[model samples]
Target chain A: MGYHHIHRYRIAFVDCDPAQIVHFSNYFRWFDTASREFFTACGVPSWRDTERGSGLIGTPLVDAQASFRNPATYGEDIEIESWVDRWSGKSFVMRHVARRGDTVLAEGREVRVFAVRDSVDPPVIRAVAVPAGIRAMCGD
Target chain B: MGYHHIHRYRIAFVDCDPAQIVHFSNYFRWFDTASREFFTACGVPSWRDTERGSGLIGTPLVDAQASFRNPATYGEDIEIESWVDRWSGKSFVMRHVARRGDTVLAEGREVRVFAVRDSVDPPVIRAVAVPAGIRAMCGD
Candidate 1:
């Protein structure tokens, strides 16, 4: 039901490191952008609706890690695969796989908590349950 | 005298969003990459010199919020300013400011901590003091 998600992007010139390789650091950035895009594609915006756009998530990261696989270069078209590997009452896990022409560049994951809701002016903070409605759309 | 610390970067094309605007999350990626570069420029290549490197920051975002002032477009030159804002014996803070042609795109920060230090297998990690040696060099 469109539960598992995978996103793809072309590695542009600016994505490369000084060594002319896609900097190891960039994989995370790519992972991040792709993940955000994944949600955006699903009609989910950022953590806040400060301007009052009303997004579904307002979470904080609790853990993250990335492992490098192969070197990716500038101007290479790569694919970033992202999915909700785990989603529970309080937290969710996202795994990202970045690759270039069958060559894997990096693999990573971020664990987060839907730890708050409402605004900070008066700060109506609360532990939010991962909405049951979104479950059928998640990966794991 | 070489102290590895966080530094910011100039946002490149790959750092933008579908709106062709500099997406809020791109700031985090640039900040992360820049911080890594700042450490490398200080001559402490973390991935290469694990013993002297700061090791993985394991930066699970405690909290991250940004204020977008102006829109930054693709290929537009942007400078991301970052610094160690606050440091405790247990943790340290890094602030990042992104600007394009005198206009501010977004301002945010990351809270990170070194988890250990000097290990043969698991890698050395610790919240070492913000080395005073390179403070002046990063400001520009």
Candidate 2:
């Protein structure tokens, strides 16, 4: 178990499809946002700040998965609870659950890596070892 | 194996993040669009027509997973190739591969089910058995 954070959102008209339910892709977006919020709640510095200090740009997703349970529509308010599920030497897993009222809407998991820009002229992203300090800040 | 369809898209500025790479969530969106294109290429009627004729509003996803192997940035032209991987009694699996030129960017899999609106006042979505005609049209 780890420290958890909840990110609240209101579904907008543009978030729904012709079927009048929230588009499935939006769940991934929400989970991503919730991950950021989780770090923020854990008192981690912004990615921009970390990038300047240690060349640690941000955590980039290597794998993502989601299971849709119930459908949501525009004008609905929902909350996503997120936390770190596990951490490895170079990557970590985050889990998120989305709900509207008492009904579960979706559950998501993401595997992300700490990344830095390579030294090439047109720099490419490369994964780096997970920094212990940042992990500690996440309160696992 | 099933009939395949390719959906090509040029990465947009807004599709990238501050890290200057395509946000992982966008890959799911592209994969989804490719699924619809796959159906179209297989000569299946549009979801609207199915809804009118057989109460089949659309194929909604129950589970989705993706693995990112490479990062893509704005202005890059990418193509997602999608096809049905398997079909069961009430659900089918769709597989998608996204590539930029010779480089593979991401691979995705989705489990989807045909859905119809329930008869409640505030109609809810419900999954139904795989429609034989639709499955045949998909050429699986």
Candidate 3:
């Protein structure tokens, strides 16, 4: 268990499908944003600054999953609570729960790794070991 | 195994992150569009038309997973090859393979169910049995 961060956003008309409910994919986008917010709350510097100093480009997902619980519509304000669930040598797992008022909307998990630009010609990126300094900041 | 449909799109600048690579969440969005295109190619009518006739709102994902293989930047053109992998009594699995030319970028799978608006006050949706007619159209 690590620091939990809550990200708040209002659903836009474009976030919904013709069915008038939020598209399932948008939950993933929100979860991704919430994950970054969790790191920001933990005092981890922005990837831009880290890249300039340590070649840490950003966290990229190797796997991501979400389970839809309830349907929500546009104009609804939602909150995604995110936290780091586990940390490995090379990757970490992020968990997020989205809610509108008291109703749970969706739950998501992401397996991500710190990465750097390894090649430019083919636009390749490679994962690096978890940064100990950032991990310490996260209190894990 | 059903009809395979390919959906093509260009990555926009907004689709990229500060790292200058296409955000992983965008892959889920493309897979979703590809799933709809798969049904369109199979001769199924749009969800709006179906809802008017048969109370079928749309297919909503219960679970979605994607594994990133390579990084793609903005302005890159990508294609997602999508198809139905399995059909159950009340749900089906959709698989997608995203590629940049000959290079494979990501692979995705979604577990989805046909749904209908079960409630309006709180906007609840419920999954229904897989329609045989739609299955037939999908050649399954």
Top candidate, metric TM-score: 2
Top DockQ: which candidate number? 2
Candidate 3: which stretches are off by over 4 Å? Answer: none
Please provide, for model 3 over B39-121, each residue's C-alpha lDDT reduced to its tens digit, 9 standing for 90 to 100: 98998999989988999998999999999998898788999999899999999999999999999999999999999988775
Best by lDDT: 2
lDDT of 2 by residue, A1-140 (tens): 67989999999989988888899999999999999989999988899998899998899999999999999898899999999999999999999999999999999999999999885434489999999998999886
| Full-model lDDT, candidate 1 | 0.56
* Span of 10 residues, lowest total lDDT, candidate 1 chain B: B116-125
Q: What TM-score against the true fold does each predicted structure earn?
A: 0.49, 0.97, 0.94
List residue ranges in candidate 2 displaced over 4 A.
A119-123, B119-123
Q: What is the DockQ of each candidate?
A: 0.06, 0.78, 0.77
How does residue B56 of candidate 1 score in lDDT? Answer: 37
Worst 10 residues of 3 chain B by lDDT: B116-125
Whose lDDT is higher: candidate 1's or candidate 2's?
A: 2
Residue range B1-140, candidate 2, lDDT tens digits: 56888899999999989898899999999999899888888888889998899989899999999999998898999999898899999999999999999999999999999999986434489999999988888876
What global local distance difference test value does model 3 have? 0.90
